[model samples]
Target: MASTIVSSIGQGTGLNITEMVDALVSADTAAKKAQITRQTNNNTAMISGVGSLRSALTTFQDAMKKLNDSSAPSFNAYAATSANESVVKVTSGNSAVPGSYNIVVKQLATGSKVASQQFAGGSSSAITSGELTVSQGGKSYKIDVANGATLESVRDQINKELGVQGISANIVNGDGGSRLVLSSTTTGAGSDLSLSGIPELEIDGTQQMAGSGAGYITAKAQDAELTIDGLTVKSAKNTIENAVSGMKMELTGVSTQTNGVGNPTSVTVAQDNEGLKKSVQAFVDAYNALQTTITALTSTSKDENDNLVLGPLTNDPTTRSLVGDIRKVLSEVGSGDQLTTLSQLGINTTKEGTLEFNSTKFTAAMNDKKLGSEVQELFTGTNGLFERMNKAIDPYNATDGSLATRKANLDKVAKNLEDQQAALERRTESLTESLTKKYVAMDTMVAKLNAQANQIKSVFDAINAQAKGS
Candidate 1:
């Protein structure tokens, strides 16, 4: 009987037992189908969680990068301005005639003390009848310095030397006949020149220093001072571009060459900390949700005999391994100038395997310049916490990632359950058809037996009636 029951359940039977077994098989198929559906749902949730976590991590990393970049100083503060006018001079030579003439500075060249003394003045003329020696290239030529030497005599002698290419002597209108002056064509720190062998002669009414020639004008300005987002900043340059990353400020009235100055200019610098705070909060919330989901999936209900619908996946080695891997990835550090660990940056793992943020501490650290700089460094280097962590979690991307792998496995299980359900359905249909045919044959046999019994009874009654009449 037991064998029969087993066979009837295993194969199609011409009885109601087969139908009953079919119903049980169908129920089993349904349970498995439901299991696959649940797993699919879980797969979707896990993928979403991983994606949200990755995005949050990226946001934190980007903020740290900007902070690190902003901490460094830059150069933007120097300018040049014009100072005073100069005059050129020519004296007398022995052979030249004394003549009052207009002298124009054809070209003005300035050289260092050493280079200037090495080259002699080119052409010369006698003015005021004085003997003057023309010195150039460390060589001096003795021309007759007398009262009658015209300015033209001095010009000609200085022009003769090869090293003296850029200097010219000119006579302009002054108190004592025409006054001699020297000038430089170049401008800058390197252009100041010194002259030797010149006596008391007034050009532009300012007494020229004994050795130094016409002074060049230079632009002067001071360092910039201002407050940005309530933080004071001092920079030597005019433009504060890198004071904070993604922000650049230009001082309107302040420049390297400002003429009128009291306080050159002022500007306000601010950052959107509120928006950043909200983003961080979202990350924390998402992380907590993921943690709760994992906990629920692994936990058991109070009912002892309840169906173990999720099966071994709740404690399966494969599932546990994946969870562990993901957790490890989230705990990793970032790259570049990131001085603070995830915990220090307000992200710490709770007992329930979720992340918690210390809002007060984090806000304080951000406002603190020194702490902020250190935190920025932790995330900005090649081996920084963010970079490493990002690398570790890269396998969970949308296509062919870790989460995708899990989802594929779940789909395969669902397909297998569907195939089993189809096979069970065919068996149930076959058994139902065979049972109906068997029941119909039995009913025909029973009807024929009843007809024979009825005929026999009628014959006996006829025989008795004949006997009694005799």
Candidate 2:
């Protein structure tokens, strides 16, 4: 592939110039190039492996959040149940104490409902315009009826002004004619319905279009009455809360018989054991996942040829130390009297470093009067397993924690690889240029020697011919 002069070197000196130069250049750069490729590949694999480890650790942290946080749902949560759902219903919060209470419904508060006199001209009859004032809980509002307004339109006007104030108006039609009915939206003594400033409609149903005075009042407002353990209680509304410490009781219906007394309804509040059990189980599963990922990353396998194949992080001592730290925290005994460690609650670690829960023993722990209280504290308390593990992991997962530091170190490794690869490439290029110049020089020298020898032989032949002729 050289000029005619360089190609002639092979013919003149019997040397394979092009092939030799190619072999020499390849040999000179092979070792360094191979080292660069191997290191680059290892750095890339480590980045991927560490990324997966961080993701798994993040998941474990999320599970820990539920167990360590006091506000979260746990076994300490309470539920309220009512013996007579028809008469009463109850709900409780975490603050509710576990106990039973008897409640009696004496009366259900009723709102005021009243109707007006029928219109002589029916639903479309015109009525004299006037101000209709309604009073409830000491709050009063007025509905203005324009002259020539129909019976139905009058009802709509009243509703429009008082709807937000717990008042409703409707037109009721009967044999007499179209009647206007007024009612309260809420049930309570303070929410009574009454009318004024319409005399004709006062005593009968609808007021006379010609006369004016005050509207009718058919029913009065009343308060709800109930008893808790023979203690009378009054409420402006049917729903009662804070009366039983976290228990919210709702009055459904009025008492059927007696002097404001009926059959007692038993309401019970207790701790939810199942909820706490599930939280612990979730923690166990998360721990196992962390264990599995660590084992796979640090493990080794045998190839078909009986050679050893190392895991991605087989050479990472930091990962091994982290795994050791996790195992140590899991086996720790918390600062609790009755139940100290997870083992006390029947959570055990296997030979492979995975956790398992024994259902029978766990049930026993939850049912144990004294142990149960301590068991709940073991995982949810300040120095509990969940809290301790979360605190330990926080340092490693923080912005400048171990995981973050490791990732930063890997980034440095990647950058260094790039620099090394670029430097090697430049060196290989310089070496190739130098080798080409040297090989071409050697080819030129060999070609010049061949040309000189050919000229000398020609001159010698010519002299021999002359001698023969003489």
Candidate 3:
């Protein structure tokens, strides 16, 4: 009877059939979504792993950089001091050799200065609109003065043009309202102040204002007089360089005291040992941190529940390979010096694959003359351990390099999966629309057929009743 009723109803049950088809479509789509989800999770994990590896490599690189910069006071640098800071102060560079020197500053260098022929006032100009020429040591400059320009404006113009080396303009208020004064920027006899182009002004380094036809010589340009080890030396300026190999002495004042805190017999330049020791320890700490990060990423451990837990990068082959590569570099012997290996300086690896520095052994090595020199060479030499390791690790840590390549590839995978998911969703939507339309058509047709069948049945029953009554 159900089949007969179904035959009469035709596709009236299509909605139920469409609903079943919709369930099937959803199931298929769910499988595709599951695949996309799995791919996303896997790619995310691998990307994170690469990030960890990169961070580790960068930390190690920074540690290596410290060993390369010997100019830092913490590494093979020189420290120079002056016994008398009041009279003389000293600072040493990497090239300075350890030595002692006795120095005496007799006179400080002076630059040429001359007060201009008194002007009317500080802001007043003798000549309103004119080009003034100032020359010094065969170098000349022409300064253009604006119409009705003041002496102050002329001063600004001269300074702006840097009119002449060692020639600076100034104004002073004296018995006269203001006078234009020009001085030298340098402190030596060769650097002398001079002026020209204006007859009202006449200045010279060696001249008296009222005597002769020359202007007043306010100050004379002179050289600094000093003695190094009793050998008289003359410097054009106060700052002296390389008088003693690798030493630059700046003379501040004349010698007024003997060798002591106020003045000493020697200026000493020596190596700073404690600073280098601290640098080595810092390198050890950085190296250990890198090692710990690698171990944590590549190893497995038991969780709080005592269940075995895998590290984020435990399955990554590249991370494991990097560890092996770094270990190989660390263990290699350096051929340039007697301090060929890290173990000689007490930098040893722990059982857990981390570095350990033995301070006692390192200090002893630092004190040994033969080993100390070689040890410094080992770290700073051209093919030193730090140098070699830096080369090995550079490609991996550089941007868009090894680790970045893996991340980029994973990014592409994720994008492709996303595209696939979008296509599947559109296909599902189209399928749902097609099923709904087909079901609606079937319901409409079935209802029309049922209506016709009922109308025909009523006609047959009416005819049969008429025949029976007759």
Q: What are the Cα lDDT values of the candidates? A: 0.44, 0.75, 0.71
List model 1 lDDT by residue over 109-195, tens digit each: 223221111112222323344444533334344444345444555545544442254544543443223334444332222333333
Model 3 per-residue lDDT tens digits across residues 281-370: 887888888888888877889989999877778968767767777888789999754578888778998899988888788777767643
Instruction: Quote each prediction's TM-score.
Output: 0.44, 0.62, 0.66
TM-score (C-alpha, index-matched) for candidate 3: 0.66
Among all windows of 10 consecutive residues in model 3, the one with the lowest summed lDDT is: 1-10
| Cand. 2 Cα-lDDT | 0.75
Better structure of 1 and 2 per TM-score: 2
| TM-score of model number 1 | 0.44
Ranking by lDDT: 2, 3, 1
- For candidate 1, the 10 contiguous residues with the lowest summed lDDT are 73-82
Off by over 4 Å in 3: 1-22, 51-71, 77-271, 296-329, 332-337, 351-353, 373-376, 381-386, 399-414, 439-470
The best candidate in terms of lDDT:
2
For candidate 3, give the lDDT of residue 166: 46
Judged by TM-score relative to the true structure, which candidate is superior, 1 or 3?
3
Runs of candidate 2 with Cα error greater than 4 angstroms are 1-19, 68-71, 77-271, 368-370, 461-470
lDDT of model number 1 = 0.44
Q: Write the residue-wise lDDT of candidate 2 on 1-470 in tens digits.
A: 23332552365467776567667777988888899899888888888888888888998887777666644445455678998888888987656888998888888777777666667677787776788677666777777877777778877887787788777888766675766777776777656556667654453222222222224344455678898888899987788988889788888986565664487889999876676677778888989998899888878999999999888788698787787777888888889886788887789999998999987787777676436555556777778777778777777777888888988998999999899889888877676667656777776787799899989999999999999999
- The alpha-carbon lDDT assigned to residue 2 of candidate 3 equals 21
